[model samples]
Target: MITASLESARTVLSEVFGYDSFRGEQEAVVEHVVAGGDAVVLMPTGGGKSLCYQIPSIVRPGTGVVVSPLIALMADQVAALENLGVRAAYLNSTLTLDRVHEVERQFLDGELDVLYMAPERLVLPRTLDLLGRGSIALFAIDEAHCVSQWGHDFRSDYLGLHVLADRFPGVPRIALTATATRATHAELTERLSLQDARHFVASFDRPNIEYRIVPKDGPRAQLIDFITTEHPGHCGIVYCLSRRGVDQLAEALNARGIAALPYHAGLPQEVRAGNQARFLREDGLVMVATIAFGMGIDKPDVRFVAHVDLPRSVEGYYQETGRAGRDGLPSTAWMAYGLGDVVSQRRLIESGEGDEAFKRRSMSHLDAMLALCETVDCRRVQLLSYFGEDSGPCGNCDTCKNPPATWDATVEVQKLLSALIRLDRERDQRFGSGQVIDVLRGKAGDRSRASRHEELSVWGVGADLSEAQWRTVIRQALARSLVVSHGDYGVLVPGPAGGPVLRGEERVFLREDPAAKKAGRSRRGGPQGRAAAPIELEPADAALFEQLRSWRAEQAKEQGVPAYVVFNDATLYGVVEAKPASIGELGGISGVGQKKLDRYGEAVLGIVSGAGTSDAEAPDREPG
Candidate 1:
């Protein structure tokens, strides 16, 4: 049996994980779990949530049975812990029979600190029997939001997890997730039967990520420019709405001499795995994928995440964007938004097989997403507000840095509404935005001309405005629910809210079309903003940093692991900034836990003292 106390937790945190202290609610959560209490921790992606449970597992008796959602995540996490000299093992489908038996024997012999398995495997009767025969310190359910049926990354396998509460009675259970709305939070609590558990909700803010949503104008070109100019040769993820889009975008990026890969469910399993492996192991390769990717990624140096299409909900957007800059360096969350994206999302919600309540929930999610895209306020503030947190402007997002201008669009909106009214009243027809805009702009296409919309009084009223400007009008209207998309063709009809606007009871102000802007280096000197500077070192220390990175790369290559598994950029930053001359001094630095200190302390000292034989020809640049 192991001793459990906050003191032991702190010791494990320093000796095993190499952290000097707990961040945010981590200390309280760790103390609670170590004292044999239950907890529900809601922290951001890079908020050091894993330590809350990881420390307690080491402090308490027996192995920690961690139920993760992905095999990739389980493998990656186990590898990382093993590198820290923790006796961690995992049982997943990828393991051979003999390897599985060895892990099981390790677990039964109480030699494992943490044992991980997918939820599917954990729910099996054989697996449960094996767990029943061993000593268990605690049960950790990572990615706890998956239990929420309406959450962005729901999994049916999570429903069976509630059994842990009843089966493992006194084994202190802790549930954790990076993103969740109040409804999802409540659902996670109830579904997982954690009503009595203490809830520790941290701020859902990723200050390191700069949020920017722009009007879609040649979005593919915009993406290319964003990558090449602002984040050239940096690892990133580009999200597309369809597999074909993923394939085409990956090919287009590759054609432009960017190393890019495509990932979606349609690809063969081996192909997807190979692509994912390469993306993890290689440096500066972008992954163009659909929503099927990036649930439990452990990569810490992703520089940016770009979306060519609108996500289904704000929660989904936040979750996906949170994948960037997990190491707390500067990064960007960018999206290309337009009227077509709104219509496409609306059509999907209306044409689905869900019940009325489900459709209503989905539409609510979409409306919130639209509001985020169209908001003139700080995007980070609005995003956090959705999750029931209050904060002032972050001064890091696009709106905070370069606020957009808005114009009195009342006349333009009245003209668009009048055209819709005329078509409905006189012609008994409704049309999509393209046809309606064509009628208003006095450039009636064949479809609009066939309907004789040219005879309408509102036909040529909007001729002064360009089509792109009119699109802004329509998108803002839809965002405000002044107009609603209906039927399979996404035809626009006056919404209930539009009654007040049409009656002149409410004034309309729309954001002016912003000029195409690409993020540039921020004048502010901190890890904040889109082009914020990463860790900076003096000239001599910078050279030392490069040499240290080269040695790390060689070590990772020899071990067949991602370079970060040896030492993340943040750790190396600590090493470079400290410039320790002795092994004891090196071990005192953050992230230089006892295991790593014993393993690489001397070599790090050598690098710092200019005595180490670094593989100079090795890659010197850190993988983004």
Candidate 2:
């Protein structure tokens, strides 16, 4: 007689996943889902969301049908599962007819543990018929937020996934997403028919990512300095607002001796796929791209995500930045913002084909993003609050690292507001922040001359500060609601708060702009604005880590999968840190599951014992 219970899930986690215990609500979620119940899991990126479904799939009978959105995700996950000695296969357009028949035969014979397929294929009549003929362990709808109309990376195919619950009434379903707002949450539950599913929301904070946004001053140099110093010898991502920008930046970085590749929808499919595979297989590679490249990426060691331009909303920003530091070690979320970004984003919104109501909602999201960028207080509190959660100062963001010095900018703010008002109300002219700054800085450009803005008393009256400093004042004022911001041309009018500040009826405090910025890794007693350096290791261990990586690279090359699929940095670091003397001791470390311990443990022990070579230690095993 066979015996397995919820307790067995714990054993599966340790033996298969190489973890001694579950994190956060993982155990509860796993147990509930394994007990034939549904779930709506809202965990942050890298929060062990996969385990919630994976462990349950193992604990129960039959095959786990995981509905994945991207082929890369399915392939990567299948590679990982196979490395753990689990019987996993994927069906998509990339597969041959013979391969499909073989996999189907295997599943029919009850030889497969998991079957991953895309939503479109899974919902097919033939595919669904095939699944109905066999036993299904469970259904896991991954990236469930794609069903959300308002979420980033919406997929229409996700709409048809609700039929899983209808067609397989007795089967348990678990809908999971790494990013979801309240609106997205409601839509996911309704669209996926997961209303009865138990909900689990973990903390949204990714404290490993150090948030930092700097003024866009000489952006090229700034980016270079940040990458060379803050992210030396690290795999990172640089996000740009435009495809042209991505290509240009990638070229620039390459010219500067940094290996970078551009990725966007504009690139050829084969080229994009090749670049992505190279990035996963290689080390210290940087990918410069738009949002098209990030979703469902399983690379675990992205050390940083730098933005050359601002994102449209805080939700998008959070999801993008969360891509970094997935391994939970220290990483950076660095960005450079300026007035031009605001103007361009506003222009795009107003010029979009959406109706007035949709445009208004878009603008509201942009305004909230501006507020976050200009915030001098706790960024985590502001970010969490936007998502209906409350949090204290996280001390990991730039603002918390070196609190901004607030200065009473009552007079300067009034002058800038007066300029915007005179240009907009009195003259019937709307100018963007750039032109308005010119008027305030006493530089009467052609636009100022044509609009007769130079004739206004507010023009050239506040030349005490430079243009950059005045721009800071204007941006902060807009963030604090002291000035109204709108229109494609950067039209600025008087808000209710603006009138009070302009009438001397209210006070405005602005963060002072530092004269010269110093960019690099954060050092002890170092100047403000440097990033915290990564964890240092002793020379011997560091050398040993490299050797271990070299060995893993060979194994991955043989398996034709990502090097991380063989072993991640954390596991490798643990091996180096512990220097396990025996196979039993090695099994005690995290990430050394029974399957991996059997495959690589002997080889690893030999290297540590100085008895075998990195390349010579590994023995040939059955092909995955």
lDDT of each: 0.87, 0.83
How many residue pairs clash in each candidate at the backbone level? Answer: 0, 1
Candidate 2 lDDT over 573-613, as tens digits, reads 88888998877889988898999988888788877766655
Residue 133, candidate 1: C-alpha displacement in angstroms: 0.8
168: Cα error in model 1, Å: 1.5
TM-score per candidate, chains pooled: 0.94, 0.93
- What stretches of model 2 exceed 4 Å from their correct place? 1-4, 425-427, 444-454, 480-488, 495-497, 522-533, 615-624
Q: Candidate 1 on 1-624: residue-level lDDT in tens?
A: 434487788888889888888889999999889899999999999898888888888888999998898896677788899999888999999999999999999999999999998999999999999999999999999999999977988899999999898888989999999989999999999999999999999999999999998899889988987787677667899999999999999999999877899999999999999898887776678999999999888888888999999999998999999999999988999999999899999999999988999999999999999989888899999999999999999999989998989999888888888889999999999999988889889995788778888888887899999888888899999999889899889999998788877888889998887767665343333221132235555668767777877788788888878878889878888888888766667777878888887677767776776777543422232211
At residue 550, give the lDDT of candidate 2.
Answer: 76
Which candidate number has the best TM-score? 1
Measured with C-alpha atoms, the lDDT of residue 176 in candidate 1 is 98
